[model samples]
Target: MALMITDDCINCDVCEPECPNEAISMGPEIYEIDPDKCTECVGHYEEPQCKQVCPVNCIPFNPAWRESKEQLMDKYLRLQADAK
Candidate 1:
């Protein structure tokens, strides 16, 4: 599952650098996570790094978007590839 930041986000940007997948980015009002890129930090970390660092606890599951484990891994791989 990809996580999303609600309007509760303070735009502190603490979450951005913590994401191992580079899934988090600054949004117009709050930070946004690309579902195509977000992996819940599954392949990268023990937990979602953004959620961990976000003090406001704005990050929550994006029910509007969903994917399987394989799909998440595929996106992680693709993001990794793009980084290279």
Candidate 2:
């Protein structure tokens, strides 16, 4: 599943640099996560880096964009391929 930044985000500018996929960015108010680029760190890490470093715990799985582990991995592979 893709992760999302909630309104509780303090915009401390911490999560953006942590994303391997470059999925997180500054939104109109708070930080936002791009679902298309979000792989939940499947190809990069055992855990979501942004969530790990988020101070306010605002990052959460987007229930609306639910995805299976296999799907996430596929996305990760595709992203990796695209980079090359």
Candidate 3:
């Protein structure tokens, strides 16, 4: 599943650099996550890096977007190997 930033987001910019997949970004004000680029850090880290650094705890799973572990891992690898 992809993660999203809620309105409660403080725009602290803490989560942006922490994302292994580079999914988070600065938007008009709050930070945003691209679902297509999000893999929940499935193959990159033990846990979601964005959620860990968010000061307001505004990052939450996007219920509308869901994918299996294998699919997420595939996405991770594709990004990982893109520079190869």
Identify the leading candidate in terms of lDDT. Answer: 2
What tens digits encode model 2's per-residue C-alpha lDDT throughout 1-84?
899999999999989998999999899998999999999999889999999999989999999999999999999999999999
> Positional deviation of 8 in candidate 1, in angstroms?
0.7
- Compared with the true structure, all predictions reach lDDT values of 0.86, 0.95, 0.89
Overlapping backbone residue pairs in candidate 2 total 0
In candidate 2, the residue pairs with backbone N, CA or C atoms under 3 Å apart (3 or more residues apart, or in different chains) clash, namely none
Name the lDDT of candidate 3.
0.89
lDDT-superior candidate, 1 or 2: 2
lDDT of 1 by residue, 1-84 (tens): 789999898888799999887778877777899887889997788788898999999999999988877888888888888888
Worst 10 residues of 1 by lDDT: 21-30
RMSD of each: 1.4, 0.6, 1.0
TM-score of each: 0.86, 0.97, 0.93
Q: In TM-score terms, which candidate is top?
A: 2
Model 2, position 13, has a per-residue lDDT of 93
**What is the lDDT, from 0 to 100, of the residue 31 in candidate 3?**
86
Q: Candidate 3, residues 1-84: lDDT per residue as tens digits?
A: 888999999878789999888898888877899998999999888889999888788888999988888989998999889957
